[model samples]
Target: MERIKAIGIDAGSTAIKVVGINEKGNIVFYKVEPTSFQMKPQLEKIIEELPKDVPIGATGYGGDLISNATITASEIRCHSKGAHLFLKGPGTVIDIGGQDSKVIVIDQEGEVIDFTMNDKCAAGTGRFLETTAWRLKTPVEEMARFAEKADREVQVSSVCAVFAESEVISMVAKGEPMEAVIKGLHRALAKRVASLAQSLNIIPPILLSGGVAQNPVIKSMLEEELKEKIIVPPYPQLMGALGAAIISMESKTKVTNR
Candidate 1:
């Protein structure tokens, strides 16, 4: 049983993340699955696999759907707590997920001070990369490699994800190198996210989380665009679920103490 203390679930739009933590707030069990249309049963099945009677903290766009959750938190709160748990201090958090992107400011005590998000469009999200990958007939996993080896970036001028694909097609038609176009896509996405982060009061020790954080080209370009070093956790995509578990543990402990 590993003496599990709490559980966290991030029922994201594109994927679901579940984390089980021991008393020390360290993850002992972790799982992720591509989101299915039948989300409720999927979530319940995962919850059933873990130890019962422990507090469950839920987050993400689908967090509210977890009828069995002990507590549900916002994506902003989950991300802030998750980033603070890893950084162990106040800083800025840039989370780019499949459907949206958010920049949150965390204060010295690991509280959310301010935040901004781009969920109305796909321009600044992981969806943009997915579209680009499909258009180029390149696997999403290989885009970073092409970008890293590129000698130059052929501009992807469209600010909209749909239009950006047209721009990419034009470049490819003109014989632009695949690597150059891929690098350009990364640059465009980084610039878009950087501008979003700069919209708020950015603090130092900036942390990057979410599935997009795994992209090396995106990470490097973000650092260059924002002019700050970016810190990424070992399991960037699992932050939301891990944060939920930690928050639930803390809250339960507080109640027991009182």
Candidate 2:
């Protein structure tokens, strides 16, 4: 077994992710759990199970919860690094997290040169779909299915998640097709993130990460809205943690070389 050289934890609003990396910066092991109201105990237990001596890097909204991390980095930096690990060059990274959406522009050297984020509201995030899913009494995953199957979609005019839900209700009341409504909601969310991606002077090789990347509807809609092909890693949700682990390994290697 390759000895784990570093560990990274992403304590996000929707999920907590832990990843261990070998000296070659390969992910050797990983664990993911739905975040609970009390995260400290869950994080502590996960740490207790891993190699205690490995350097730990933490990122995400709840990153500060990990008091003993060797280093803590912003999600923009971590996501950019994680995407770069796969892209290996300049690109734009769009991360539609549970509660926020970030568009990061990475330089040729794989460093973030500019970025934009939509954290002020849920309209531009996975939570937007989640909220609409709840309002429609449909599973979030099933909502994507509904959208994909729709022949055509209605317009979701509101950019506010709450207002969008009300708009959805109004459309449903007006006899709009459920599938059309769902598809419209997804298109609206994708457009919001796409707008963020366009806020910066973006480059090629666009990548999508975070849990939302798994939604086929979102990926397709984003590609349509941005008019660009986007790459989604096999394990999109784990990128933040993987990036942190990569950073840990890189930092450790640098120190040893010095």
lDDT for 112 (candidate 2): 91
Candidate 1 per-residue lDDT over residues 1-258, each given as its tens digit: 588888899999988999898988888888989899999898878877877778888999789888878888888888888899877888999999999899999997779999999957889999999998999999998999999999999878638998889889899999999899999999889999999999999998999999999998999999999999999998899889988988888775432210
Candidate 1 wrong stretches, greater than 4 Å? 253-258
**Best-matching candidate per lDDT:** 1
Error of 1 at 9 (Å): 0.4
Best by TM-score: 1
**Per-model TM against the reference:** 0.95, 0.93
Q: Which 10-residue span in candidate 1 carries the lowest summed lDDT?
A: 249-258
Candidate lDDT (C-alpha), each: 0.89, 0.88
Assess the local accuracy of residue 51 in candidate 1 as a C-alpha lDDT between 0 and 100: 77
What's the CA error at residue 154 for candidate 1, in Å?
0.7
- Candidates in order: C-alpha RMSD to true structure: 2.6, 2.8
Pairs of colliding residues, candidate 1 = none
lDDT of 2 at 175: 99
How much is 128 displaced in model 2, in angstroms? 0.2
- Candidate 2 collision pairs: none
